[model samples]
Target: MLIGEVARRSGVSARMLRHYDSLGLVRPTGRTVGGYREYSAEDMRRILCVEGLRSLGLSLRQIGRALEDPACTPSALVGDLIRWAEDRLEREQELLERLRTVDASAPSGWQGVLRIVELMHGLNSPSAARRQQAVLAPAEDVRVPTELLAGAVLAESDPNVAGALRWALARAGSDAVASVVSGAYSENVDIRRRAVLAIAEMSGDEATAVLADALRDSDPTVRRHAALASGTRGVTAAVPTLVGMVVEGTNDVEAAEVLGRLSLDPECADRIMAALVDELAAHSADSAVRIRLTQALVEMSGTIAQGVLGQLAHDGDRAVALIASASLRPVRVVGLPDDESCDDAGRRHPSQVLRR
Candidate 1:
């Protein structure tokens, strides 16, 4: 077909055709005698492959091998990619586990969720963290509606159910898990806890206030989960609330876990340090709080995480002990890029970037 005809049929710009030509991706069979470009059926198939790879979350460079393999099946490709995901999740879980042991302030439910993420990290190929990374990177926009996520959660079952909801929520938002979170909040304490789990798994600031309201819930599990959810989404406002609970509130295991995630904030570094100082001044204080505080310091250091072991070389805490004992420790930081923010900046202009 002629370039103009191909452009019209493909809904791809002529300029993009030239760019693809330059990439030597969809090269012509031979030039016309008049020197105009001509595309064959084979070239069209290659273009279709490019489009398919783009939709499959593969970068053009990364898609080269797959595009070249005519026998490549999406199912097989996805399965291979799943193995890579499995390894990453396993490693991330181990790191999270080490962080948890040292972390005393974190809520039990928060730990439980992290553990779950640890167990099921490879359940989905594109995780919430990975999806957020893709969302924030230089690529075409892919929006999944919240309603779609909610419905999918109900239609699916365990193993796949949780991961699918998380994947959708990462691209969508809390509204995605609205049905599950809403349904759980009204049930028994355990049910409410599961709801909070759903919210945390697929969470952000969208339901921060709603989760915050749960902080005062009669159920400790609900309150604990709210604390953990706020931390995952970086709801700093809940810091003071969590601190109050840790200082004078219940000595619950769940509360402690939330405190651990809570105290992880670098912004609250000074506050946590001062808390430790205050405890040191009172010689009769409980070792339990002190243990959590040390875990908090090590965790905070890990979170800030650049040359942490070197900087904390002199800290006398056992949690800081990880710093002294190092053998190529791997540190992973996951989040959205600066440009592709989900809060409000992700909103698209009406029909912008639409193909005719």
Candidate 2:
């Protein structure tokens, strides 16, 4: 077969075929009567071999060595090729993700594109401070991509940087809610905690729904954050968790205050009081737990807590009795009758009774 005929039949361009011949990767092994290049059957097979290797991302030099070196083993060379291709695939995937983020941002020009790219690089910087600055210093006219910010917030560990990232994510608005929620389901506990914290800062039905789901997370840390935020948002679903927090003494003070406010709702007040009273009864043997619960009662507004406190004033544990007795003093004079009245100011303990 002539060189032109081989190129035409094999779909290899003539220019590329000539270059392959020059590289010694394939030689015609014959000359026509007219001095034209004539490819023998074996030459065509060699050309096909080189093309096959090229399709696997092998460099021409590597391909040449692969074909020429009798000592070269296919297992070892193929292994190397696989590794190289995998590395390239990973890098390409990262580049493609960056490109998708940039396109999602909808930059107006190359300058906008460059700015966003720089911000993304900074967000991925090794130093926490640099990542924080990237979030803080975005161009006034350009919007930082929410997906990028959401991912950063989930992985950020530094207290200050995490706060800034959460703030930035909140500014990124509800579009970031789903990304942050996905982080809540991460296997890493720190990421799950960060996700809940970030979701706490976001507003909207979606964010609220995510928080509600987080309230039942297996990680106690995640559940506590969700409860605190959900309590503030008036999510009565957090009542049981908040009550448990009061019993456990972890963020118990804040939990009590939120529960107190939540208790103002007529429908929730009885249930809230019942939960507190039940915890108090359940943990009665632990004096410290009882003391904490007794103190938490000061934040409740309904008559149920007042009645509970009145009964606790004479609790079997002296410390519990003392704390409950002292907690009641500010409510009224020492002789004020129980189940009677100490006036409206004394009816329910002051809202600022406990600070956590």
Candidate 3:
């Protein structure tokens, strides 16, 4: 196949194919006398496997070994990468401490070494002014240092460092975007959650989709954080999926809160159907959750309010009624759409269903 055909089949750019060839990770089995590279089907499969391992964060050297040795476990490679990441984080901490120790104005015998360390730190620090210049500068001049900064910042102990790195990366655009996700799929939940939030904030479509996947995270708090971040991004594409999770998933009050928040939007109300309201109203669940759901409804009063409240009131469970009653107590603010929540705040506004 030609490079374009290979690029289309493998989703690896033509330029990247050339890069793989230079690295000897994937090379054409034969070359024309004029030196144009042609790929056989076997070569294309090899390139795809390389792409997959790369997606898993294997270094080309590391992936080469795994590909060459079928017994090698990719999981072991992941562990090695994680340790490598931790080592970098520790180095970042040490460097930050060393920088803090070196008083800029101090006179010292080790001034030269201190200055060198300071220079390395300076190279690490990216300023907003420098980043803006990269945006306007010609591509030849745009050495935005994206991978350097992203690697340095995988776990910066300071927001100042991370924020500066993020700005510098904005100069590099979507290419810089993948670094956030590279960290997200790691075994670390905290790492994944933070990466997911950072990516969602960057307004990247790939990041938005990946963050939604993180909502199924084992760490409820991470899932909650990821869910809220995705919802806040207004990626309504995730609304239907979130709606099902809210309606059926148990012990996921935070997910429910985010779902309720998203569905409160006029167009999303229908997705927050009676099943979801009942699930939220189910007193068996956490009270904190019921409160959040009621609060969400109060914030989005309309037909949703009337329908949810009326259902709660007519149900045999007076428990929901009590929650609704509490919601109505302040009727000053939207109350929990508990059963009796509306008895006091009742259909006074006339039951309104948000038109689809």
Q: How close is candidate 2 to the true structure, as a TM-score?
A: 0.83
User: For residues 258-345, could you state the per-residue lDDT of candidate 2 as single tens digits?
Assistant: 9988988978989988887888879878988888788778888877887888899898999888877776674433444544344576
TM-score against truth, every candidate:
0.34, 0.83, 0.43
- The weakest ten consecutive residues by lDDT in model 3 span 134-143
Q: How many backbone clashes does candidate 1 have?
A: 12
Candidate 3, 187-306: lDDT as tens digits: 876666556646656666776778777777776655655666687676565554454444444434555565556665766666555545655757455754555454445434467676
The superposed Cα distance between candidate 2 and the true structure at residue 43, in angstroms, equals 2.2
lDDT of 3: 0.61
Shift in Å, residue 289, candidate 3 = 3.8
- Model 1: residue 200 alpha-carbon error in angstroms: 1.4
In model 2, the runs with Cα more than 4 Å from the true position are 13-15, 28-38, 109-111, 185-190, 331-356
